[model samples]
Target: MPVKATREQRVGWHAAHKAACGCRDIPASLRPDVIKLLRSRRKP
Candidate 1:
């Protein structure tokens, strides 16, 4: 059985994935989550 990923790990993985794939024009499936993560980061 596989363990689930933590929120931080998921965010880190998503960021890394975007970095490797280029962030300028992400696929629709990944776009929402990526934007949500970025928005979270920007919040003070």
Candidate 2:
């Protein structure tokens, strides 16, 4: 991640990292946004 990454960028990188590595979880600070993103993807 960059020194000044935006929230969306951080979230995206974390999501991808989780899928590709599975070595760590998303940080607590970004959980809500991660949930929101997951929910939105499930919608039509």
Q: What's the C-alpha lDDT at position 2 in model 2?
A: 92
The lDDT for every candidate, in the order shown, is 0.63, 0.78
**What shift in Å separates residue 18 of candidate 2 from its native position after superposition?**
0.6
- Can you write out model 1's per-residue Cα lDDT over 1-44, one digit (the tens) per residue? 11697655665567666666755565566667776777776647
TM-score of 2: 0.66
Query: What is the Å distance of residue 28 in model 1 from its true position?
Result: 0.6
Off by over 4 Å in 1: 1-23
Angstrom error of the Cα, residue 5, model 2: value is 0.6
Per-residue alpha-carbon lDDT of candidate 2 for residues 1-44, written as tens digits (9 for 90 to 100): 89999999988777767656869878999978876776665647
TM-score of each: 0.44, 0.66
- Identify the candidate with maximal TM-score: 2
Q: Where does candidate 2 stray beyond 4 Å?
A: 35-44
| Residue 18, candidate 1: alpha-carbon lDDT | 67
